[model samples]
Target: MSGTRATADLAARYRVAVEADDPRVLIPLYDPGALLDVHVPHWRFQVEGRRPIAEQVCVLPRPGRFTTFDGEATRDGLLVRFEWRQNGPTGDALVRQLHAWRLRDGRITEHLVFCAGVWDRELQQRMAVEAPLVRP
Candidate 1:
């Protein structure tokens, strides 16, 4: 269970977990001892173990809607990306991110994530208008 097929499977499970907002839905994909490394702006931190990692990673911290994109397999893992859309105290916002996952025996042993900071709806629209995506 490696390569593109495995990556696809991981995406399906991840998407299901996110949509269900259930950490339990994501636990099975993780090893008993798994690590979640997160990077945002100039800061970085980690969450350890399947339960804790699943708990933190399964859903957005605050109220929000999100869209999951397709994942691609790397030599030892897969890259999973998504967008978070939220309406906060200020207004509508967006955050984009991707996770680089390492799997073995069909279970995730670790994953690293880099986040694109949150942007208000206005900035999102401006970026959309000004920046033509070279690739989706």
Candidate 2:
């Protein structure tokens, strides 16, 4: 398959795994020594290796929440953006993020995530936060 097609397919599978809340499904998609860099409002860290990445995925919100996922293939990777909504202390909380993955030999080598802060119902609709990193 073409690189673009492969990247798109892999990205779609990644989205499916995330929506299903099953990190195990993404194991085969990553390189053994893959690196994941996560940057969110409250936390910033890096996880290396597929095992750690999977563990990180497991901690994310599972089913029962509302999510919208969109992905596209870049020259050497994939760019995916998603928004999630779930119950919160005051009302519904919303989270939005952009995930960029660099794939080699059909496996992801580097994954970077840029996230917006969790926002309450009203704030979520009114706030506009741009992603810190642009596609390179």
RMSD of each: 2.6, 5.0
Candidate 2 backbone overlaps, count: 0
Q: How would you encode candidate 2's per-residue C-alpha lDDT over 1-136 as one tens digit per residue?
A: 9887787788777777776777889899999999999998878999999978976755553333547777878887888888877664557777788889898899999999898866676775564444333641
Candidate 1 least-lDDT 10 residues: 59-68
Across 45-75, the per-residue lDDT of candidate 1 in tens digits comes to 9999888888877546456777556677888
In model 1, the Cα lDDT at residue 1 comes to: 58
**lDDT per model vs. reference:** 0.81, 0.78
Error of 2 at 67 (Å): 3.8
Scored by TM-score, the top model is 1
Clashing pairs in 1: none
Question: Number of clashes in model 1?
Answer: 0
